[model samples]
Target: MTAIPLSWWVSVATALFVIGLYATLTRKNAIAVLIGLELMLNSANINFVAFNRYTTPNQVGGQIFAVFVIAIAAAEAAVALAIIIATYRRSATVDVEDIDSMKF
Candidate 1:
């Protein structure tokens, strides 16, 4: 069985990151931005695992780091969603352009 090449993993991660970046930048909705952020984080996780597997198969550092990233992403999503919800309640919309002020 042939192992997958590092370049392939890197290419996939890069593509994912670009798509996420585009989505984050182009989307005006808060939920869409959050989805993009999650995609970007997932791409990073892919890179971490891929590099770890290729550079040091025996060590688990990469996986550990990926786990931490996942944790952080989850926490960020929760908090961000809470904020979005509150903002929507006040402004009646999730459009980024409409939210010009943070004052409540």
Candidate 2:
């Protein structure tokens, strides 16, 4: 059976990563940063799965690593969300710039 080209998958992943990077860098909200981080993690997973499936159709190593990455991403999201909620409660806002505590 024929499959989609590897380059296509790589391009998709690259696009996702770039979008995520842009969101993380440009957004002032903590929740938006977390969403961007999730996008980046998902992009990496796509690369892992695409390479593993295309390059080593006989082995499942890539899938396994991708699963691990997913688990880590989930945990990271949970922790990050908890922190954001706490910060929002304390400051009444989620803006990263307004939450700065080191201001003299």
Candidate 3:
């Protein structure tokens, strides 16, 4: 069996990042934006693991960093969802453009 190249991993990560960025910038729905953010975070995790695997096979720094990123992503998702839900309750919609103010 042959091991995959680092460049391949990088290419995949780049694609994921690009798609995520596009979704984030083009989507008008809060849920879609959140999904894009998650995709970006996942791509970062992939890069971290790939670099660690290629540079320091014996060390786990990359995996550890990826784990931290996952934790942070979870926290961010929870907080963001809470905010979105609150906003929806107030405005009856999740469209980004429709949410123009912070006033309740």
Q: Per-residue lDDT tens digits of candidate 2, residues 1-104?
A: 24799999999999999999999999999999999999999899999999998999899988999999999999999999999999889989999999889687
For each candidate, give its TM-score against the true structure: 0.95, 0.94, 0.94
lDDT values, one for every candidate: 0.94, 0.93, 0.94
Clash statistics: count for each candidate: 0, 0, 0
Error of 2 at 26 (Å): 0.6
Better of 1 and 3 by lDDT: 3
* Residue lDDT tens for model 3, 1-104: 12798999999999999999999999999999999999999999999999998999899999999999999999999999999999999889999989987546
lDDT of 1: 0.94
How well does model 2 score by local distance difference test? Answer: 0.93
Where does candidate 3 clash, by residue pair?
none
Candidate 1 has its poorest 10 consecutive residues by lDDT at 1-10
Give the alpha carbon lDDT tens digit for every residue of 1-104 in model 1.
13788999899999999999999999999999999999999999999998898899899999999999999999999999998999999989998878988546
Model 1: pairs clashing at backbone N, Cα or C within 3 Å? none
How close to the true structure is residue 32 of candidate 2, measured as C-alpha lDDT? 97
